[model samples]
Target: MCSFKLRPSKLSRYFCENLKIMQFKNTAEFAKKLDAQDKLASYKDEFIFPVINEKEVIYFTGNSLGLQPKRSQKYVNEIMNDWGGLAVEGHFKAEKPWWDYHERLAAPLAKVVGAKPEEVTVMNTLTVNLHLLMVSFYRPSAKRFKIICEEKAFPSDQYMLASQVRFHGFNPEEAIVEVKKRDGENHWHLEDILKTIEEVGDELALVLIGGVNYYNGQVFDIRTITEAGQKQGAFVGWDLAHAAGNIKLQLHNWGVDFAAWCSYKYMNSGPGNASGIFVNEKYLDRKDIPRFEGWWGTKKETRFLMEPEFEPMPNAEAWQISNAPVLSMAPYLASLSLFDEVNMDLLIEKSKLLTAYLEFVLHEIDVELGETTIFEIITPKDRGCQLSVFLHGQGKALFDYLMKNGVITDWREPNVIRLAPTPFYNSFEEMYRFGQILKQGILEN
Candidate 1:
């Protein structure tokens, strides 16, 4: 029951106009109507989707790398223009003030992740920020040193945690606990995670989990888990790379001790653009907490005084070890402006329906193919736009088929494909056509 229309999508390079008010069918016509009804439908034009063989391909890998915003070029150009015209003076003389460029993004980013502006700041890459935060929060004692995380967290996180534990002189096999789903299960059960935390009791010093599992698209109940971990005297934090902009968050209110995320995936801030971090207000004022310090992290009033002593800022900005990379941050500033306008609530609403419709279409495909269905969906109902499709046996060939046929989906090792119907620029009609192409791929295979 996904019906939309296709009336000149006022934002991108998509076709099919004068095709509105149609029924929800398996036909291309139904897909077009669904596109027309989308309030965010027009915004698709603002992005640049890749064209394969002179035809536009259906791009569905937003969970990996998002499409570039048309305005990204303009934003970068403005910075280049300032650099060209003003040279070193641009640091203080530019229209937006490059000296404090990173500060400008704090407010907008706060709105995106649901935190006070002072509690959020753009900083290093995901794992780098994770290491920085762990320095302060991961103070392990002899009686309490175990850190709990999911089994298949992104490789970078796994390495960082293992190293952090090793740096503390603890055996990783005993210090790091990776909670896993039951055998033959696709998604993780929340109760199982809570039980693990409870069993660890006071021995659990920290709980570091991915807000959304990268491979299986399982969205964890962050608030509940944080509460459970805290009840056992564990400091809780989240690796939110896949969850940041894809799902609504309240990191501050959830009492999360700390969290970090990259902006490229869901935030659409170009590859390796910058990462954001959140630290609760309580930790911001405590001088007792240990952290690495740099010139930028010192208070603005004394930052230029060249004083011998280090004085940290009163917020998450204290975590910054260096000045902002203005050029790298330009694309993010451009994208954050868009987030400011549309907001998370509206974007998440469209994402829910769009992904559900995709699930519906895939189930229909499963019914037609009987036991030889294309793939089984591993993502659960609590997910964002991403759906991790677990294919049957060496599915790389099927992945190649989809790619060659103008469908862009993310392929993971073993036998899984990740597809995300991002509300920012993806259409329901694209989902319908993707289903059509998938059906054809299955028939040919």
Candidate 2:
């Protein structure tokens, strides 16, 4: 048995408690034994995997794009069939009416992100939804025009924030305050984030950050940061592209003003699927809020009445500018069905142990290599399943070797590889196999 120091969380506690009594072995038989005992072992069959060299590739890129659910085709086919048979009547005649198809995902997505059903809605893509959320939340005045965010956030987020400040007639360099990581540190410290928010003080109008960083896979303290920013009289929101289905969130309980996430990642929807947004209940049905209106966002009673006055929906759907993309949302709904079967609590529990096992296997491979470890896992313990490993004394040749040998991983510029072993489809056996493949790749290179 080994003592693992993980970030403080309910899931981490569970992982540590189990680790204290169980020994981790770096053998194929041990991996199979663990998989045999896995409750979600059958879930691997639910997703479609790419095969290379006559074997299913070990996928470790769920942080970027999740594997497609096998049922997704059925969902998409239903939409296609409805569109073909009913034509214009599909809006109301179809089994799942096209008009309110997006509504099907609201409840399940709310559970995954820890929000009220009314607080969540499926709509535009990730960046688009963030921009829309900023329209209502990022209110800037002469005295309160500054925004605080993590340094080197996902490039799309950086662009959105910059464009937002500029749209409000403020220079980005002066209005945007980025909380920088300490020298030689891979992750941001919570104290630094709160301190920056405090220092910005009255000038801070908005605090928008990624709940989980894309590069380092660090999970930010969303609740604490939201409270700190709001205490300073600033609106706080999150871009949950990497956090939504990967980590546990309590958006409503945390009192976050607004947030958005893409379903294509950990939610296991197809690539570039529709995004989901969360709006605090306090902000819902408010006539005072600034928003871009559309017919789809109006109240259902008057949506077809052709009224000149815009009557917004009483929930988060009020932020929607147009009709839902049912084709894109079909797969998302399909993926949510799987989530409905396995709640976030169970998924998170499995994630903690699976990621810990992956970490253990990585270390085992490092020990087998030499006295000096050639890998440095940049992702901190305050993370979900993603482990961003920096390869020292190894280059793209190793990455290429892994790809050629049927390992699907995400490669970042310089020399880092992000591996996310999703709780649903990814198995403990794959983690052990990855470690062996990695060692062989290094040796061969």
Candidate 3:
């Protein structure tokens, strides 16, 4: 059912025509034609779009922050009503009470990551969860102290790993091993990574990587990477901020030791919502892993006994340092309910088609523009939802122009422009409009 037909894209026909007068009519026709055949067209109604200058802007910035669902307001209202009605007793007295709310997010999150229910828990923000995971997993000593990560990871993740190394009484310069692409290589070589693990089998302590890279949109082979790290006696963790809802991940089967991700990107939760964490169920009974404990981490049945002694919960819940933020969680609950309704398998089928169509359309535009075109897609072939395009040298100018025209895609510093066509809410018509805007932006700049 996946079709890769390129019938004159809306943006292409609009701006590149010699007949300036007929362009508008041609574009309108092309847009509607694409929409008529669009498989995921009905999904457009699911999201809230920003209206600019009496027109709805084409939103392509799901990588930065996804649009909120309409149900989020009602979800938050119920939580607010519970707070107003029950006050201190709302933790146990209300419908969808505070006590079990964190657990409510776990099963859906587990399905997203291919984790067991006991292995995944809704917890802190992405970087915060990363640091908390390091507290328990990053057990470095004199011999094995270095952590391996990508050279161009999200700046926050880089900072977290550096600070974590320094906190463990090690210089980041010496303790953090940054795996970069070889000279003249545009992307990382998996063989090189496997070789590095083999070479440093004794000295490596931890392996952390973005599940799907934020800048280049490279979906790393997580299972192979995790196996290589574990073979080197390194604890492997993934920052799944971009990958959590965008791709199908087998976090447990991959033998990933720990992972963390935010909900605001493709997950469609509101900004700064509570994130999820994954701890392999193998660690469920292993008390040797040191954890920073709190009352919430204590056994739930005896938590109210107010004993100073911390008896940690049996599973990933033991990692919880405090009670959750109910307001933030309400948005995730709203978004996650949508996921449960439409399973990841079905969403992934739609995602591949959506992104493939975007790529096909972009490439077709390039071909029409002749040999001087400079846009280069940096994302790998196997990536999910997002495509990172490098505009040779005009990244900023093109990006500014696109923003000026009310097309909202994100630009990484220096070059790349990242556009994510999320499966749940993005439409083929929107992709058509975006491609049209992109062509105009590039031509004008």
Candidate 1 ranges beyond 4 A from true positions: 1-24
47-83 in candidate 1: lDDT tens per residue? 9989987878898999989889999999889899999
Better candidate number, 1 or 3, judged by TM-score: 1
Instruction: Order the candidate numbers by lDDT, best to worst.
Output: 2, 1, 3
Question: Which residue pairs come into collision in candidate 1?
Answer: 4-33, 4-34, 5-33, 5-34, 5-36, 5-37, 11-45, 12-45
In lDDT terms, how accurate is model 2?
0.91
Q: What is the TM-score ranking, best to worst? A: 2, 1, 3
Candidates' C-alpha lDDT = 0.86, 0.91, 0.82
Which model, 2 or 3, shows the larger TM-score? 2
TM-scores, all models, native as reference: 0.93, 0.97, 0.91
TM-score of 1: 0.93
Evaluated at residue 212, the lDDT of candidate 3 is 88
Screening candidate 2 with a backbone cut-off below 3 angstroms (N, C-alpha, C), the clashing residue pairs are: none
Better of 2 and 3 by lDDT: 2
lDDT of each residue in 347-387, candidate 3, tens digit only: 78767666766776786667667676567888767588888
Clashes of 3: 1
Compared with the true structure, the alpha-carbon lDDT of candidate 1 equals 0.86
